[model samples]
Target chain A: MRPDRPTADEMLEAVEEFLRDKVMPAVTGHLNFHARVAANVIASVRREIGQSPYIEADQRERLMQLLGHDGDWETLNRELCEDIRAGKTDLDDPALLEHLRQVAVENLGVDNPKYSAYARLKE
Target chain B: MAGGSIDAALEAATRKYLSATGIADLKRLSAGASQETWSFDAPTADGLQELILRRAPGGVPESRSTAIGQVREARLIQICHSHGVKAPNVRYVLQPEDGLGVGFVMDRVAGETLAPRVLRDDLYADARTKMAGQSGEAAASIHNVPMGELDFLEEITPLQQWQNTWNAYEKYFLEWSPSPVFDYALRWLKERVPARDRVTLVHGDFRNGNIIWGPEGLRTILDWEIAHFGDPMEDLAWICINSWRFGNIDKPVGGFGRREDMFEGYEKVSGIKVDPERVKFWEIFGSLRWGITCRSMAFTHLTGHDRSVERPAIGRRSSECEADLMILLGRN
Candidate 1:
């Protein structure tokens, strides 16, 4: 995997730059709109690839402490959902609120850091 | 309708209905999964008329259970227009003889519906200043439509709406892209379902993008597909949803003005004191509802119902709603 000069993220950046600087300017109508969206999508994927490992590790640690147990990422998340839906968790609990806030903010950092709410919070 | 040319049929039908010699410049504008919009002009006894046709493509039935079908949507506009709501003017509904399936023809109102242009463009500065108050007044008028004439619409209780959306979201996203934020918001909403004593017509999708405006101000309210009978506060809060605000997040009323101005506008028209608490509750609900809608859109991509890149991109927006929920719930 390390045998290449252009890495995954770099390749994605090249594609995104090409779309924005070249392809987008060369297109019109529906294709123009979709080209912009495609460029944004590539950017989003680059962000997700760079950020997911750290974010997921943080989320797993928080979920484990909140639930007081150990499990895989998907299972732990599912259990948390069930607990909240079943009224097992207190909505007003400070720890729970902090955990939810941190998760929302971190995921938003990967998904769309420029979102108004996320950007305002980051500011 | 199947074997015949749709263009010829449409022209023939408009000629008889509008007393026109012919129709010209007929063009398809856009097509959603269930419906098609077309624009054309007719030279008639009354002079040239600019019109829009909203119809199901090839007579395909509506897929969304929540939509009040095209026929009923047109009638609702006619009723609201009769009540001075600035709704679109319906010229006529396509008859069976027209072979055009279920649809209606209406005069095309000139205005802007795009949010960014309306919010930031210099052309709409005056309109942007007046939009929130006008939107509030229009919503008030819509909520005041007499109940006797609305038997055709469904009356959805708050719990019914919440449960149906939650169930559908759970079915689609539980195994795919679960959101703990959504679960938390759902519980928060369930525990605080506001008690309602007044049920009125809720323009289920009233927002900036659904409205038509110009420099002079609001022209016409469009898109009645999801109109129903529900809490009036739902309409008030829906316009304030963060997603509708575009980038002007500070301006909560459709990214144009303050909520107080909108509330004032509603009170002046409806003679009823607006409740801020109920509006906040529905505002949170609106955010969660949109989050669920984003999940559903993503599901369309996953399940191959629609494989467009836009679907997954919208799915990414669910996190935006989650971030919005955190802020709304004071967790931020």
Candidate 2:
């Protein structure tokens, strides 16, 4: 006898129902540990999806265009990360900080007052 | 209990306790990085009651407590509560025979202690007005706590505290990452260590997040794990650290009120004027201390004892401490 195959949405619904009803109830040892497990699972999924070359190339192009950078995007990201890790580049650096502010505003789809204030501080 | 193995032990303990008093439902609460906190519902023959249980994880830093055992923490909490400090009322200390490892049960107070919400929530919009007044009063109350009354507390000379902290940081750095920034900060700190004026019972983690705020105002001060005998200014300086200021760097006291207001509040109650220069010295120490703590967390992850993204994120916050160093050194 063959087993029935569920649609994608149905499978997702079934998994959600199982987690809410059966799985979560049994795993009550430590709340923080359980939350960490859930977060790690989600993070792993995000990492797997983020590793696609097409997605990476698209993200890089978007970032470079936003920053108005002609150099390689990966190198720019590495430099930015290094700068942030060290105390050398303040989040208040004018040109780069302004570009970051614009990106955040556009991504969030809101004219956030906090970002505006942050941009002004950078200036 | 869903897990049947521990159920028998729980039942046995419950029965033993029930002979004296009824044991209500046990609900596990949020555990901190090193401790497990649980809310125990205790029902007497009369009614439902709630108590908090704190248990230590197997491996933790030696600096967390001066003594080797968990009973010391329970005793300290009890002493703090008895001294009229707004702290949890410790009820019972669980011995080793209690099936549960080492732990203590205390009366749980209702309040918010999370940092971000305390800083940004509209519910606490008026916190900016009241925080300085509350912190001042709380600090005065904590400082007024007579050290001689507590037999369990160790008395150390005020000046020895600097050496003790320096030694702890040195050990912590050797165990973790040996960042040059920490070395620079330590060198600067040793040169800048001020003369001690007076020693008081210091709440080593005395800051915005450690205090619980409720509808009744400040209900209880939490986390006495790092409590020690030190200069009173250490508490004041810990409160002024930029990390505890949340995102609002404007207000020095938990980013809620002016430094002058906090000073005036403490001065009025304690009858001792705060030394600005002395507080600044401790404030620098606060940054260095926190930076070391971040490194220790990273060590926990690297050693394969525990792995969490949050730990590494906390390690990344050492840069903030470096920024604080720059600000303190007049380089920013």
Candidate 3:
């Protein structure tokens, strides 16, 4: 990382603040909507950067245990999906269900923390 | 039609078809994935007419096989309207000489189309009470529309629908990343694919956002671009999808009422018994379908087909569907 005063996440925070406070207020119609979306994108990126490492690491370990063998995150995920599609993995496996649910909840946390399902599940 | 203003073409077309002197307030309406909606007022000999023009975006013909296209959408609305469904009356389909491209103009029905407002606004409190029941009645009426008249629509069985959606997801997976949750949901759907009890006209996109309502109740159903022949339960299950609930998770039927209320209204209209199991199957299917749609829309952005910011944002919402799917699968 560069020795910058504003780090990546900090820069994103500043951009999000500008978008919400400066740009959105001045815009109208679709532009206002787009500005809101832009702010949200920045927020999502910040959350993903902060949270995804832990989430993906947890998911990787779970997948390793469930599948009994594993590679990296993408490879293991692809293998699990393939097994599911090809009927190699038992559909009613409790471990599999738990893994899927945990991953979904974790992803939703980064994608949209305010999503109702995630909030309800968190509660 | 490309760069030129559509004012002359619209004026000429209305004059020829509706005997209107001219049109005013030709403003673009908001939020359609593959189509554009424009609201205008026409002054005819009879009176001033509020009309809406729904057309393909940029006058380009919809090449997507999933969409039934604007012409067919107009016809579907017309047919449903004739069957006492709360649908808009199609006034005139634009001709080739009209220079307006592929679309149809219809008499605009005044109502709030925004789902958030319909769900939360004080004015729509009464409407919310009646919406699910009315939605059921509307679905029944739509289903009751003679299938013989809708021969033009594509008939997709439950398995076929699943295959098509899965194929779409697979394409996305190949180009992007595999979603294990989606795969799991698809497998679950395949394992419990509902039988085609009876084939009927399925409003493939029947959800909260596609409906327009007023304080009294449902004024109109909009966006028939994906009308097809499928299991009637698809419509019932579709509206019950958790995503459509818009945070009113307890009120399953479009965030306003119960599934029982909706089923009751449907049964009252069509005299057909509601099958909860079948609806449940389709509800799961609906989540997967929506997830795939979210990913597909995001791919449009990722691939630079349409770089709208909203597209990638929606792509992230695939996780929302995954979360909903996990709940629906009883695994949460």
Candidate 4:
């Protein structure tokens, strides 16, 4: 139903290019700051779209194993938060720690891959 | 905002309080959705004066959050200024007849509030070394503010504030989905609330970006809307929070100087020894609070309260906190 040549990622790339290369030259001050932010938003959207499925699948598997239950991503994550809050889950368990670390790192990949701390943690 | 009307209002308010006949070069410097800051020149009989106006727009209802609203914020400036704390001189609070919203006028201190310029620019190299200790001395002065005179500032312990923020964040964020790292942070913070019995004036948001500095050194601390009575260590720890460091994470004290320097400065001014454990606990507490704050930025955007590009962009930074929290927990 959709043309595949100009995919969602490509569309975002085009918009970012236009904003950075074309529109950016004409703006200054607060609007310029916001323009860069707008461009970054599009780039983030592209990353999120490309990366979310893999990240979510990995998270779902970890949550299911750690919580000993099967459910959708949001419901299980909500339960995980509640368990940790109410002292039902042990934070020090090796499996649980791995799950948390991987989840945090994967999300960082989508959100801010350039966050300087990430490089140190990965190493 | 009608510029002419505001100028007229400024003249009237200043004439009564500052004995100024007129204001010139009036301009709005920055305005959030709720508040506005204006810079202007006021001509008194002696000479020209630089002044600032911080105000809510007309007819905007007052927010009941723990923020020390405008008039009282002015009071903090006045109190600190009187005590030689390098704060601006609060000149006048707006009256209704002045046609301006509720706010106060103060002497505009000249310095750079921008973090990038204050950090990377050559003009601030000397200021950088001096900033951390200056920040500590400044905090000591703020904490030593007379207790009786600060009756209006909210007197609450850090633990209570931490719990309130954690609970609010849980309801706001956790209901949508689970946040393992955030929940872990909350539990960890609850267990280690600093064992401080005495209450002191706490500059609730003392951080690098909010501080004003120039070539010489730290000039003044700004944004006292959330000043409160709390464990003094909360202020000390808050300055060391990673978010305030910008990207210079190596130097924990506001990304400019050593933590020991801050302690030395604080002890020098107040003659009270800092409990290292208490500062450490508050540092963890600081990380948790900042992590929660980053999450709120996303929620604020999602709820349509503020649809700025920065909102969702900042929402992404919630993960940055999540990562930092893990590191702090020694999970790495």
Between 1 and 3, whose lDDT is larger?
Answer: 3
Q: For all the predictions, what are the DockQ values?
A: 0.75, 0.04, 0.81, 0.69
Q: Is 2 or 4 the stronger prediction by DockQ?
A: 4
lDDT of 1 by residue, B1-332 (tens): 34235678778889888887888888887766667888889999889999998988776556689888889988999999898888999998998888888899999999899999999899998777888888888889999999789789998888887888788777867867578888999999999887657999999999999898889888988888998998999999999999999988999999998999899899989999999999999999999999888877877888898688778888889889889999899544
**lDDT tens per residue, model 3, B152-248:** 8989998899889888987876557788888888888888887776999998888898887889998888888888999999999999998989899
Evaluated at residue B253, the lDDT of candidate 1 is 93
Clash pairs for candidate 1: none
TM-score (chain B only), all candidates: 0.96, 0.86, 0.96, 0.94
By DockQ thresholds, what CAPRI class is model 1? medium
Candidate 3: misplaced stretches above 4 Å? Answer: A1-4, B1-4, B31-33
Candidate 2 structure lDDT: 0.63
RMSD of each: 2.0, 9.3, 1.6, 2.0
Better of 3 and 4 by TM-score: 3
Query: Listing candidates in order, what is each one's chain A TM-score?
Result: 0.91, 0.37, 0.92, 0.90
Residue-wise C-alpha lDDT for candidate 4, range B23-98, written one tens digit per residue: 7898888767556788998889989889889987552436857677888888888988888876788888887887
User: For residues B69-137, what per-residue lDDT tens digits would candidate 2 score against the true structure?
Assistant: 456777877777887878788867766677666767777787788878777777777665778877877
Over A1-123, each residue of candidate 4 has an lDDT whose tens digit, in order, gives: 156978878888999999899878899988888899889888878889999998888898989999898999888888888888888877678887777777778877778877755665565
Q: Which candidate comes out best when scored by DockQ?
A: 3
DockQ head-to-head 1 vs 4, winner: 1
